[model samples]
Target: MFLTNTLIVLATVAGMEAFAWLAHKYVMHGWGWGWHASHHAPRSGWFEANDLYALVFAALAIVLIALGTSGRWPLQWIGAGMTLYGALYFVAHDGLVHQRWPWRWVPRSGYLKRLYQAHRLHHAVHGREGCVSFGFLWAPSPTRLRAQLQAAQAQRRAQPRQAPPQRPPQADTRGR
Candidate 1:
């Protein structure tokens, strides 16, 4: 039973990454841009409107855990996995990549560098469209991401020119 629960937790974590990639690309970058747009803009306070998505996911995990404790099988483990993913996302995405916190250790090499560079490439685009590297925990190679970005930029340039959308105030911290 313990092994089964562990497997469930691990599988859920992996599944969440795939789910997150889909949701980040379609929902967040698509119709949910109303909330997610705040993430791209320079944050004025300690929080952005995008943080609400995390709250929603956290609420789901809480509900799953409550239901599992009430005798529903496996949900507790699933919730545990979700909670773990959320914590990792907070640390890697919010803390390390975006530098939303005061801890300022930049990764000079290895997977950390790839993760950082991939995310930064994601933000290289000005608006919602043409962004790359939607996943948080798992990222593609930085070289591949840059090539994709370049292709996207070239495609956009090839299209008929229109007045650009009203862009938000870009933060100066993108290079870091």
Candidate 2:
């Protein structure tokens, strides 16, 4: 029973990547930008409004553990899964990509580099719109991402240049 529960929890944790991708694209970069925008903008302090989301998720895990411990449900395993996923997210998203922590060991041409490149592409867009690669665990090839960014840059350049409006030469009053 314990092993079964562990597997179930692990599956849920893995499945969370899909949920996370949707939430990041629709919620975090959407309406939730009110808080999440702090992440994209230059930092002013150690903490950010974006950190609130992590705190909220942590609180939820605590709640699940509390219930599971009380024998209310089999939520303990689920809670554990969430905790572990959070730790992994911190290491991958924060430590490896953002350099939030001091652990330094830059990867060269492998899954780690791919993940780093994908996330960098996600941030290529200055704002929330036009960003891609929302899934942290499942990243597209870095070559593809680079091509996409370059294509976008080219498209921007292709847009018609707007010439300044010429002043409708001085009216007839001047001629009169």
Q: Which numbered prediction scores highest in lDDT against the true structure?
A: 1
RMSD of 2: 4.9
lDDT tens per residue, model 1, 46-127: 9999999999999999999999999998899999999989999999999999999987988999999999999999999889
**Distance from true position, residue 144, model 2, in Å?**
2.0
Q: Relative to the unseen true structure, what is the C-alpha lDDT of residue 8 in candidate 2, on a scale of 0 to 100?
A: 67
Full-model lDDT, candidate 2: 0.83
**Residue-level error in angstroms, candidate 2, position 71:** 1.9
Cα RMSD for candidates in order: 10.9, 4.9
Q: Judge candidate 1 against the unseen true structure and give its global Cα lDDT, from 0 to 1.
A: 0.94
Clashing pairs in 2: none
Question: Cα lDDT of all candidates, in order?
Answer: 0.94, 0.83
In candidate 1, stretches whose alpha carbon ends up further than 4 angstroms from where it belongs are: 162-176
Tens digits of per-residue lDDT for model 2, 12-130: 68977777888899999999999989888887767789889889888988899889889966787778777887888888887898777757766788899899889988988898877
In terms of TM-score, the best-performing candidate is: 1
